[model samples]
Target: MIPAINIDAALAALTDHWSPKVVARVNDQYVKVAKLKGEFVWHRHDDEDELFQVVRGRLRLQFEDGGETVLEPGELCVIPRGVMHRPVAEEECAILLVETVTTKHTGDVETPRSRSIAEQLA
Candidate 1:
């Protein structure tokens, strides 16, 4: 039997900001946890939608249209495929991400904070 995952424990194991680690997988999707403290790159997934659920603190997703969505704990938002957005956190934040197995971390844009799938899995 598979063991249950403690989200808080999984989060505690993370030490890097903006780097997400794969915690679980359901069908073709991956459940990831990440810590954020600053601004992320503006990017979009061309073929896959992304789900962001705030576990702690606050997160603001800024869109290309100059609008933004702020999420607090227990709140979630879904970013549609091909929509450009950036996540910003004035304070440290913990988030849960649900995306397809093939989704890239920063879409097609490579940045210093970008992590490869292998890195995430590790």
Candidate 2:
């Protein structure tokens, strides 16, 4: 039998902010967890949509269109492919993400906070 994963335990093991760790896989997608604080770079995935779910604290997604959405714990948002967005948190926040295996952590732009697939898998 496949062992169940303890999300809290997985989250606790993370020591870096803005870095995502892969926790599971579903077909062509990856389920990841990340601890984030401060603002992230603006980027867009041309072909893969991304899903963001707040696990703790809060998250604010700022869109290139000048619109923004704030998500509290248990809340989730689906970012359509090709829509530019940046994620920001006033304090440390935990989040779960679902994205295609081909999706880039920073989408179209690479920043200092970006994490590669290999890094995330490791």
Best by lDDT: 1
lDDT of 1 by residue, 15-98 (tens): 999999999999999999999999999999999999999999999999999999999999999999999999999999999999
Model 2 misplacement above 4 A: none
Q: What TM-score does candidate 1 reach?
A: 0.99
Q: What are the lDDT scores of the predictions, listed in order?
A: 0.98, 0.96
TM-score of each: 0.99, 0.98
lDDT of candidate 2 over 1-122, digit per residue (tens): 99898989999999999999999999999999999999999999999999999999999999998999999999999999999999999999999999999999999997888889999999
Off by over 4 Å in 1: none
lDDT of 1 at 72: 97
Clashes of 2: 0
**Candidate 2 TM-score to native:** 0.98
On the 0 to 100 scale, the lDDT of residue 76 in model 1 is 100
